[model samples]
Each structure stands twice: as structure tokens, then as C-alpha cells.
Target: MMTNPTKMERRRALQDSLNDRINFIKSVEEIFNCHMVNFITGNLWDKHIPEPIKEEVAQLGEEKVLELIYHFGSCNSKLEVKMELTAPCPTLSKYLIACRQYYYDMTDPSINDEESIRSEILNDSSTSVSDADDNIKKRNLSSQYLTPAKKRHEVDVMSSFIAKMYEKKLANQGIIGAIVDIGGGKGYLGSALALRYGLRVLGIDVASDVTDAAKSRNDKICRKLSEKCSFYQQKTVFVTPNTDLGNLVKEFQFLWGSVTRVALVGLHTCGNLGASNIELFAATKTTDVPVTILCNVGCCYNLLDEKYLPEGVIDKAHYCLPPLLHGHSVDLPLDETSGFPMSDFLCQRQFWLGRNARNLASQSVERVMSQKKVAVDALFHRAVLQTVLLDYAENCSDTVQKKLLSKLDEMMVVGKGVGRVYKRNASLNLHEYLKTAFEKLDLDIQLPVEEVDKLSERYDCFKSKIKIFYLIRIFLAPVIESIILLDRLLYLLEKGINEAYLVRLFDPLISPRCFALVALK
Candidate 1:
């Protein structure tokens, strides 16, 4: 990963980086393009995986496959990656190595090397006494502000990276005095920047309630560190393509603030927020507070819009969502187009990764091993539940029937929504999963033992097979993520932002969405 985005010919860099990845993606395109819920929930004993990879998994069995998974864990202290496991399952093993090797130049956390997540310059000796003081003070933030230890690790990295850039921005242009923190939550990033770097910050959140909460939190923090903390403010606005950020904050007050120059930044921005920030950065030609730079870290690949999955495509994901969220994915607006394929290169290639694939891309083999649980059960539940949903559709009214699959016709129907019935991180017992899910779907309380048994039989002999099937999908996670992130970098490059760059900004185990996209004008 290029930590110092100071010097580089970005155009050639992006082109060179993109070429092989394009080839890699083309070769493995079918793996990610399939509807995974449909595929994984199918007969893993027979289909749902490539024959070569399937044979490889069958030969290696479950324990070896799991050991290989443990080799990828990083960023979490509790999880130690087993160094250099033998390549027993050649097909999947090679895929894992290739994925990690591909990551080497980006984040440097390959399976052969376990300590790559430790930053080279993280504890760099600073001549600035204030910098040293601030670093020491930051250690107390987790205890003081109720931030998680893992979260503090993320904040430290981002703070260091952004502060270095901000200093250069100040020394050269001397214009940017504040950052526009997009998708900021309760001004955490703002607090860090202001506390350590003496930078002014304006935290903008899409949620009004959060913005209000931020004000209260900021007031408390400000009073505690009144002398050191100069300025941090919060605002609530749904920043859109048409949003004029300069004008939005023009009337806003700042104690130690200037609108002459500003940077648009977001840390682990969920879904479209990251995309929207980048778009805002590009679109803004503001006279009020000129956004001279941008830095964004995006998560939730599944939350991203699918370019081809039309706006009206039934959001079969959220069954119990309120009426306000009925027509959309969540609180955010859905566009017919997506934030993906941002570069002309990818757009021209007609590249597409469906919802299941995107969700799969969000999976971390590292986290999977660290936690020691494959979402095999959750996925199993969802898949078997898909059949129930299909069966239930037969009883619904004509209007309701039109929205779902009429039969178990596996032509193109997506398995959606039943996962919504269960808690995201809950380890579900099969009985509980059935009871709760059945009740949620308005099915009979009496357990459908026979139907469930028939479905269970499809996967009973293939638990190892199912785990291995998931391993490969999880292995492909970072590769596809790298492609998506690189696409964003390429997008900036195509836009002629020569200073545009990507960095491995967070520890992958602590925070899976570690790559950040940055640019300066």
C-alpha cells in the first residue's frame, strides 16, 4: 500500500494496477456474478461450486480448510494467523494466495506474512512536542469517550494520515483550516482531528437525531478540553449530488474556522455516503468553502446500489421495514444507477456484481477465522427459508404473488428478507431460526419437520463441503473489494486528479473496510 501519497504519477500507476486485475476479474467473473444465496443454498454435494475447486475442498476436508482460513486473520490481537500452511487444496489454496498476493502491493497483509498490518510509521518519532503530547492524550479517548479499543485503532490511523495531508495542504496553500466530515457520527473523527492537529472541523450527518446528539457530545468534550480543542461543529443534511456544501455551511458558526479551503472526509462511510462524498468532492466548485481535497473509507458493499438492479426491483431484503423505508433500501435514496463502475474502463467492460456477490465481498476470511464461525448456518437458514417463502407465495393474493416467485422455479428469483428476521451476529439454533422465521413470515407455528428434513437432507452430508464452498467465496471477498476500491481510484485518475491515491488505512481484522480513496486539487 502507498502510505505516502505525496509523489506519484497516478495515471500510469492506476493503469498498471488495473490491467492485471481486469484480467483476474474477467477470468473469475462468473464466481462473483452468480446469485450466491441461490448457489450456496443449493446442493453443495453436487453443484454450487466450480468442479475443480469442489474437488479440491472434498479432498482437503474441513479442518485443513479452516486452518487455511485462520491464516488470513489480521488487525485483532486475539486472533493470530497461522503462518505458512501447506497448499493441500491446490485450487482454493492458490486462490487464497493469489488474493493475498494481490493484496500485498495494496495492504501488504499476505498469508505468508502475518505482521503486515502493523504500520511502518505508526510510532514514528515526531520532533513536534505537541504531536507527541497529542499522541499520548489520544490513548485516553477510548476510556474517556466510550470508543471501542478497535475503533480507537482505526481513528489513530486515519487521524495520522489525514493530519499529514492537512499539514501539507496548509504549508503549501495555507487555505484549508477545517474538514467537512461527511457521514460523521457524533463528531468522533472531528474530535480527533481538532484535539490532535489543531484543525477546525464541521461534522455533517444525514440523520438529524445524530447531529443533535453530536452537539451534546461536542459540548461535553469541549468543556473538558476547552483549552486544547479549538473547534468542532455538527450539522444534519442529506448531502446529495445537487448539494452545495459551501452554502450549506456558510451561515454556520465556527470558533476557529475558515471556509477559504476545506477537505471533504469520511471514515468508514456506510453504503452510498462514501460514494456521495466522493461525488460531492468532484462536483463542488464552491466559492463559499472550496473543497480542495477528499479522503474516504467505504464499507458495506451489500449496501451499495446495483447499477443494473433497477430502482423498482423488489427490495426483498427488508421485510419488516417501516412504510417510509418501503420503497427504498433504507433511509437513503436509491438511484437507477450505482456508485460502482465509476471509471470509464469498468463501465465499458459492463462489469456487474449482484447483491449476494456484494454481500459475499463484504465477508472477511480473516474475521471468519478469528471469530471461528462461517455464516454457513445463517446462509443455510436463509436458503431453506427461501423455499418456505416460495411456498407461502402460492397462498397470497394475486397482487402479493406478483412480487415473489410463484414456485421453486430457480430461473432468477433472489433469496431475500428472511435473514432480516434474525439478529445479524446471533448464533441461531436451527429450531429457533425456524420458529422465529416462520412466525415472521406468518407461517404455521407447528414446525414443518418433514419439509425442513427434506431441505436439510440436501446439505446434511456436505457440512464440510458447505464450509469449503463458503471459504472460496470469502477468499474472493478482498479481490472483488480491491477491484471496487481500485475502480474508485481509477475514477479519480480518469477525472484528471493527479494526486488521487488509495492507501491501506485501517487494520483489516479490526475493520475489514481498510482501504481509503484520497485526492487533492
Candidate 2:
């Protein structure tokens, strides 16, 4: 009555199944649009992507572009909402759906009758078993992801999927002895993995407040998730007060000298701190003990090496902009800690507009008194001074003081691109204004204006180089992933590990936000 499928026929059927899966993914992506598509596709990563990774990478990049757009691409601050992968691969999707179904089945009250229960179990259990059987069949059909390959192929793919891509990346083979998280605020990322994956985690931060907060959070999480992270409270240590990064590394090594497999994971490590971790890994090398992995999610690249060059950090006195901005080495007499506050930077450019308005108004008597270092309650009189600067002749009680501030404000330039910002009808060419300012400043100096211009040009050129460095750090994650693959190959050649595999499993919901680093030996 029925004919069995031939080998060739079976192969064709499998190919058709794969086509269906691919089409399903593509259709979902299209439906979700770019941003949502990126979030969802991240769960479908493979080590050797038969298809290009560029499409997903570009989609993920849109998340950053969205942030740039929200603040009108302001020089300071970024959009705060985090992008997450909501849908992963079909397997994960099914798992999630099944879990939800199970939860609902347990909690939801359904019409219960003896006959209905018996019928449902008899029919539904068989259907579920058939569905499970179909899932096993589909696994083979999805050859691109589940194709029979060497163990190494699977591991490489899995590793690429689970781990966040980073630069100067580290690969771990055997047991991870200790994980030191640098600038690991709250140790959320590191602690999570340590608890889940079973490792000792040390959270290193300069701020005692941050470390203490992380400890509290860790304790709270441990209390709630005692079953899952029972060892987390015991294994995790918070280290602070010693912000000196180099000294911290030395101390860490001294404490755990016997640890062979060490990993350093940092989420949003700021400024030059991220780069310092790389240097520590490269500089501190041993034949017996090796730093296995260094994972960093770096933010605020503008705060990197103060000098305009790669070698800037070596010289203590040389002050440069954080990796992201103009690096000027003619020290501003400000220490490493002195710079624009994150609060100020993260505020919208509108805050600068308020400052500009204040600058444009004429200075008040109170302002003059404050400038002369007189003890005036400048805050209380600021409102009165504002009205006087606008030339509103309101005979307020503080008219005399307001008049003085208005005059002073008239002398001061607004929108000079320094302290406060003012919006111009048309975009102001800040570079041109800077050139003019430089020329004017040279008028009083013995140095010729032409010489000053030459110096400015040199500084600009150096700043460009610094920008390149920042860009590299900004995109370090992907670059690191690539490097770690090469490291794995090298490790294979050296016989440090054997019969191992790696793979990158991407989530489909959050634009493949993370990879599942599968290690199978």
C-alpha cells in the first residue's frame, strides 16, 4: 500500500526541509524589520557560516545607529536601552514555547472532566511523542546547523555562538581556575557565568561604592537563586580601593600564581582600562600558566590613552583625550580623574543650550562678585540675572545686581564651543571657529600665527590616529572572535588540546546578540 523512500529521495526531502527552515528565518527577519530582525537572528550563529555574516552584522549595527539618531547624534551621551535577542534558532524557540506551554498547563485552570483528561492524555501524549520524533527528524534535515561533522567543527561553531566577540581574545581549553573581571561594575556578567558555568569570579573595580554594590547584588541574587548559584556567593570575591590596574594584575597573579587557566571578563570596561587588560595578558606570560581568555565589553573609548599615540600611557605626565576625542599632550594640569563627568556628557545637547543662553546674557553684579572670588549667593540671584541679561527692564527688587550681571554677560561670548552650547540657525562649523580662535590667541603671543596653525594641523593629524585606535577598540569584539579562532588552530598544532570542537550558536530574536561557545572534546 505504501512505498519506502529511497536514499536519493530521502536526501531530496532533507534538502527541502532545510529550504523551509531558511525561508522561515528570512521571512521572520523581514517581518520584524532591521532592528528586531537583528535581535532575533543573533541566536542562529554557526562557526563556519555557509552564508555570509555581514547581513546580520549590518543589522546589529543599526542598534548603534538608532542611539546616534535619538540624541540627534550629539557628541556626548548615548541611548540607554539595551538590545536583546528575543528569538534564537528554531530549537531554542521550540524550547521556549514548550516551557511556556508547560507553565501555562501547570498554572492555567482548564475545564477538567474525567473523560476529557483520559482522552487528552491518550491522544495528546501520542501527538507529543510524534512531535518529538519529528524534531529528531528535523535535526538532520537542518544540515547547515546540524550536519554530521567532526567534533572540532561543532565546538568551534558553538564557541563562536555563545561568546561575545572581542579583540585580543582569549580561548579556554580545560578547567578555568579563576576569572578576574576588570572594571566589572556590579560583576553582573562575570558573576552570572561563574555561577552558571562553575568558576571562581573576582570582581575588580576602582570604586569601593561600585564593588560594594556588586557584592550586595551578588548576595541578593545568590539568596534568591540559591539552588542555581549556591556557590556564587562563596566563589565570587569583590576587590576594590586599588584602582591602579597594573598593581591589581600583579596582586591577582601573586594570589593565584598556581592557576593555569585564567579568564578575565569585563562588561563595559571604560576608557583606557580595557586596553590595560590586553597589555596585562600579553606582558604576563608563562610556559606553565597561561591566561586563557580576556573578554571585555568596552565603552567610552574617548577616555583611552591621554597621549595622541599608542605609546601615550607609558608617560604619566602626557595627557591625551580619551581614545575617542582630540588628544592634547600639553598637560592641562588635570590628573587622570579630572575630565567631563559622565552625567554631564550623557545629558542631551539641550543642557548646553541653557549654558549658552546664560553666557549670551550680560553678566550681573552677582556674577562679577563671584568672578572676583567674592562670597555672593550666586545661585539665589541667578534668576534675576537672567531677566536683566535678556534686557527685560523689570523693576524687580534685585534690579541693580541683575543689571551688573547683564553687562558682564554681554562681554562673554556664547557658543564658543567650550563650556556651554547654543543652537545656531544653521550648523556652525566648529573647526573653522577653532581656527579663528587659534589665530586670535596667537595675536598676543610672540609665536607667529602661521607657526600656531602648523601646530594645530599637527595636533589634528595626531587626533586622527587616536580616532583609529578608538575605532579598533569599539569593534574589538568581532576582531577578538576571529583572533580566538586562529588561536584555537594554533593550539591544535601545539597539541595543548586534542579532539576538541568549537561552534557559534546565534540567537534569532535579538539579532544574534550573543554566541553559544560550544566546547566538545
Please give, for residues 52-107, the per-residue lDDT of candidate 2 as tens digits: 22243234453443332222211111223223432212222232232223212221
**Top model by lDDT, which number?**
1
TM-score of each predicted structure versus truth: 0.77, 0.31
252-304 per-residue lDDT for model 1 (tens digits): 54455346767788988987677777777777464766777788999888777
Alpha-carbon error at 159 in model 1, in Å?
A: 2.6
RMSD list, candidates in order: 6.9, 23.6
lDDT: worst 10-residue window of model 1: 109-118
Candidate 2: Cα lDDT at 243: 31
How does candidate 1 fare on TM-score?
A: 0.77
Q: Look at candidate 1 and give me any clashing residue pairs.
A: none
